[model samples]
Target: MAEDLAREEPRFPPAEADVLVPLVPARREGGAHRVRFGLAYLALAAVAGAALGTTVVVLDRPGKTAGPEWSSWQPSGDRDAHPRQIADHVSQRYRRPSGTQLVAVTYAGEPQVQQVPLSAVAIQTGGDGSDSPPKFVQIENGLMYNLCGLGPSCAFPEGELSEGGLQLLRREALELALYSFKYAGADSVIALLPPNVGNQQDPDDDTSRTLFFQKRDLARELERPLRTTLLAPEQPQPAEIDPDEGLIIDRLTQPRLFQYEIRQAQEGSAFLILAPLVGG
Candidate 1:
């Protein structure tokens, strides 16, 4: 009976059918998933690259620049040797851009200049101690007044008049005073020889004590004082004069020594006052 049933059914064991699993469909699904993951990773990489590129572009631009530079220039030739020529040069160049100029002067190695408008005046004065009191004066932006005085005659041990006294006075004056120029008008300036008096000594005594006066400080004392009533106002009531004119200017033009007088005897004392030269 078993043989007959086996022949009629042509049957295999159920275990063989179970053994034929759907391997191809599972492999296809796994491959599809892997492809999707790869594409996602590529998209993420592209996004990161784009973000980095944007960051790099924003960090490149421009900023601030520099300022104006002044070239080293000497005055019209050596006209600096003469105060009057310097004044004229300053007058001619006395404007900026449309109408201002810068005038500079140097003593030893220190240099000073001013920015003045047209019509301002620049002045420079020089003399022996005999013409003006030896003094040092400086103004912020206006006129400077100066005085020079000559040395007194002196007798040497030989009972003869010695030129050494004059020479000493000249040296003292040269060391004591300075020529200063300041703006006097919109287009002009005035030169000044400031007094540098060290003291009032007897003409006969070579060893007398000298009293010194700093012209610049004295001018300031006249304008503004410290602690004491040493300064006296100008007399003759110059008629409620606008102090500004005497104390102000567009700017201060430094003094230049055009010519120097070694020993003229008329002891001179020049006083300088600076005032604004603009605004009515």
Candidate 2:
């Protein structure tokens, strides 16, 4: 009975082959989903590269630098930073030692005068001398009176300065004026030469020679350092004068000396009266 039962159970053929069924569908390599993912990856990479490039460019760009501090003289406060103080500083710094005379070449057919250190510096602040700093912007349209002479009388001997000597004197005056304009923040500077005093009692009897400088007139020269500008070449002689040398001649060599006066008005306001001397 056991042998008959076993033969009956083994009658089915090797039980059907095992079959496997996947849970999800298979995808192709070049399918739309794969292409979309590749494009998104490339776009992200491109955006990252662009951002990095922009950062590098911004880091490499140059930036503006601050201007130089030209003078060692610093004011105690803004209230003390006035043209008069600047002038005083300049006069003290540039005062010539006793018994030293400035020498220069003599030119024919030119007036002669002696060159000396600055004696005093006066400021016309377009005010009644009460304001600490003038109410108006004097740097734009102000007058700096630089007095040059030997004594309180501020008189110079006649025929002591040749044309070249005068030119040298003018150079000195210009240097002072430049320093005043730079440190004092003035736009205009007038350097007054000592008057040819016939009488020692009255020094103002004669018209004093003058040299005027304006900031706008010296735009090119001001771009350089004060030392380089001061070391400019000597003035050319009349024979060596160039037509294009108008700046050098008008500013340094043959500056027309004008006589100026501060006339007080009836209302207490003062006005500057400028007139060209007869032979300026």
Total clashing residue pairs per candidate?
71, 1
Clashes of 1: 71
Model 2 over residues 2-115: C-alpha lDDT tens digits? 342222211223545775644767467547777987887787777767766766676676889867654435434563245555445444433222334332111111111232
Give the Å error, residue 280, model 1.
16
- Where model 1 places Cα greater than 4 Å from the true spot, the runs are 1-26, 64-272, 275-280
Candidate 1 lDDT by residue in tens digits, 1-280: 3342222222333544446655566777778988997997787777767765655555443456643322122234342343433344323432222232211222221111232211221222233333443433332233211222222221122222223222222222222222222111111122322222211233333331111223443344233322122111221112222344223211111122222222212333222222211111
TM-scores, one per candidate: 0.24, 0.48
Best by TM-score: 2
**So what's the TM-score on candidate 1?**
0.24
